[model samples]
Target: MLTRKQHELLTFIQTRLESSGISPSFEEMKEALDLKSKSGVHRLISALEERGFIRRLANRARALEVIREPDTASPRTAPRGPAPVKPVAPAPATLREPANDVIEIPLHGRIAAGAPIEAMEGATMLPVPAALLGPGEHYALEVSGDSMIDAGILDGDMALIRRTDVARDGEIVVALVRGEEATLKYLRREKGMVRLDPANAAYDPQFYTPGEVQVQGKLAGLLRRYH
Candidate 1:
C-alpha cells in the first residue's frame, strides 16, 4: 500500500492532468504534497517513475505524465529480500554465466557496394546505443591499413560501420565480392567495372564486373583500445 504520502502525490498528479489536460509542474506537486521544496517531490516522482507509474520527457518543463496507476493494494507482502545476506558466499558451481560484460553492440544490416544504403531487417546487432557515433544503425569491422591515418582509422582498429547500399562513389565501405571475401575499400564505378580502390597507394585498385562487387556496410565510426 502507498504509505499515504505516495497516494497523496499520485492523486495530485492525476487530478492536475485531468483538469489541465497537461501535467502539473514540480512546484505544483510540492504545493499539493506540502513539501518544503520541489526536490522532495522530485524524488518521490522518480520513485513513482521507477515503479512504472510515470515517465519524464526530455527538455519540457510540464514533463510529468502518469503511465500507470500505482498498485496500492495488499500492503507489499513480499517479505523484503531476506535481510541482505550475512557475508560473501562462493559462487554456485553450475552457474558459470560467461560474463558478457562486452555489451552486445547494436548492428544495422550491411550495405551493398555501388547502391544506396537500404533498410535491413531481421539483422539485429546488440550494442550500447549510447555511443554518440554518427548517423545510421551501426556495425563493426577490423581496420585493414593505415591509409586512412588522415581519416584517423588505423589497422586493427574496430570500425563501426553504418549500413548503406549507395554512396557518392568515394565513401569507404566493406565490399564483398564474387571471391566470397569482404574488404574495406573506397567504392568507385568507372567505365563498366566498379573499382575497389584502397586508400593506400601501395595497394592497387581492384576492379569488378557489374554484379561482382557488393557492399556489406560503410565506414561510419571506429573504436580502438590497447591490449
Candidate 2:
C-alpha cells in the first residue's frame, strides 16, 4: 500500500506521462506536490523506486519511468534494468539526426533579438524530433536579429520554444512587455522589475515593472540552416 503523498505523486506522474508523454521534471513535481524543495520530491521518488513503483534512470535529468500506476490491481515488481537514455535538447547549438520521432508545432513567425517585432500566428506546422523537444506544447519562431548572437542564436535561425508562461532567472525567454510587445532575451526578475538582458554586449538591458512583463515561452532548442 502507498502512502497518501506517494499516491499523489505517482498519480501526478502517471497523469503527466499520459497527457504529455514525458516524465515530469523535479521542479515540476515539486510544484505539483506543493513541496518546499526538490529534495522532498526526490525522497518520495526514491521511496517509490525502492518499493518497485517507479524506475529512475541514472545520469539523466527527468529520466523517470513509471512502471506501475497507483490503484492498479497488478502486483508491484521491480524494474529489470535501467531506462534507456536519449539525447536531450540543451540551450545551445543542436546537432542533426537522420530520422527520429517527429512532432509538429505551430510556426509563430519571427521574433526580434535586436528590435521587438510583432508576433504573428500562422497555419503552418514545423516538424521537430520528439527526443529533442521532450514534452509539453511547443512552437517555433524564426529569429530575426543579432542581439543573441553570443548565445549561439543568429538571424534566420529557427528557435524551438516550449510553451510556458513562467521562467526562472537567467533563462532565455520570450517576454511580452507591457502586454503588447514581445522580445527574446535573458530574463531576470528583480524585486519589482523584470530585466530583459541581451546576449550581446552591444545592446543595453531593458527593464519593466513585474506587472508589465509576461513570459510567453522558453528556449528549448535551436535549428540553424547552413548555407
Candidate 3:
C-alpha cells in the first residue's frame, strides 16, 4: 500500500511519461509534490522503487521507468449520516474523447545547436496553437544553444517540428548527422555537399554528404516563454 503522497507522485510520473516521452526532472518532481528539498523527493522515489512501482536508470538525469500505474480507484467509505440510508449505485463510466481543437506535443528534451548533444526524451507536453501546427506529426524540442540565435531561436526556446524524413534546401531542419549526433540548422545541398548552416556567425557551417545527413524533422514554428 502506497501513501497518498507516494501515489500522487507515481501518478504524476506516469502521466507525464505517457504524455511526453521523457521523464520529469528532479526539480519538476519537487515542484509537483510541493517539497522543500530534493532529498524529500529522493526519499519518495526510493520508496516507490523499493515497492516495485518504478525504476531509475543509473547515471541518467530524469531517467525514470514506471513499472506499475497508480491505482485510480477510490476506497469505499462508510455512511456518514445515520447509517439508515439505502445502498447507492455507482454511476456508469463514460468515455472521454481527446480534445480536437488543441494538440499535445511531446517535448523531447533539448537539442543542441552550438554543439551536438545526444538528445534525450521523456519531456512534458506543450499544448500549442493548432494553427501553428503543420502537416504530419508534430513535436517540440527545447533549444540548448545560441547557434541559431540569428534566426530568432535562442537558448531555452522550444522548437516546434513536423516529423518528416525529407527536407528541402534552405529549410531549417533537425538533422541527424553521421548517425551519431543531431543538430538544428538550415539544410542546404549544393554541389553534391550537404551543409548544416548555422544562423550565427560565431560558428562555422558543417558540411557532409547526402549519405551522412538524415533529415529528422523540419521546423514548423518556435515557442518562447519570458520568465
Candidate 4:
C-alpha cells in the first residue's frame, strides 16, 4: 500500500502530465506537498521509483513517467452483479525510438569558477541536448577554475547559462563584476553589499557594492564531456 503523501504526489504528477507535456520541477513538487525542503520530494520520488510506479527518463531534466497508478478505489464501490464480457482486439506492434533533439547555443568563452576573470565572446557554438534546457534564452561558458568544485562544477565543465538580469538570493549565477569580468558563484546579499560566495572552502567570499555587480544570467544546467 502506498503512503498518503506518495498517493498525493503521484496524483499531482499525473494531473500535471495530463495538462502539460513537461513534468513539474522539484521546487514545484516540494511546494505542492507543503514540504520544508526539496530533499523531502527527492525521498518521495525515490520511494515511488522503487515501487515501480514511475520511472525517470535518461538524459532528461525534470522528466518522469508514471508507469502505474495506485489502487485507491474502496470496496463499497464494488458492483453488485457480474458484468458481461466483450471481445477485445490485439494491439498492433510498433517500434519505439528515443528522442534526439539537440540545440546549438553560443559558446561565450571562459568564465571563472575560482576568481573573477575576463569573459571573452567567441563565434563558436555548442550543441546541447534539448532535454537539458528549459524555456529561456541560454548560452554556454567554459569553466576555468576549481572554486566551485564542491558544487560538482569542475574545471573545464560547460556551464549552461540562462540569460536573466534578476535572480533570487542563494542561487548560482553568472555575475558580471565592474562590467569587465565574470565569475560563477552563489549570489547573496549582506549588509548593503553583494557577496559572491565560492563552493570551495579554501576561497573567501568576494563582496562589492550593488552597482559594482551586474546580474548577467543564472546557472541553468551543465554539460560535461568525458575523455
My TM-score estimates for the predictions, one after another, are 0.44, 0.60, 0.54, 0.60
Instruction: Output the lDDT of residue 40, model 4.
Output: 61
Model 3 Cα lDDT, one tens digit per residue, 147-206? 999999999998999889998899999998888778899999889999999999999999
Tell me model 1's lDDT, rounded to 2 decimals.
0.57
Q: After best superposition, candidate 3 residue 218: deviation in angstroms?
A: 0.4
How close is each model in CA RMSD to the real structure?
18.2, 12.4, 15.0, 13.6
Residue pairs clashing in model 3 are 21-122, 22-121, 22-122, 22-123, 23-122
In angstroms, the error of model 1 at 106 is 5.7
Q: For residues 44-160, write the lDDT of model 2, one tens digit per residue.
A: 776787777777544344556677664432223325333322222222222222333345678888889987777655647776654455445678899999999999999999998
User: Which TM-score value belongs to model 2?
Assistant: 0.60
* Clashing residue pairs found in predicted model 4: none
Runs in model 1 with CA error above 4 Å?
1-103, 106-129, 146-150
**Tens digit of lDDT per residue, candidate 4, span 1-227?**
56778778977887777666566777688889998865467667777778777777766656777877754442234355322222222212222234544557789999999889977576487877656765557789999999999999999999999889999999999999999999999999999999999999999999999999999999999999899
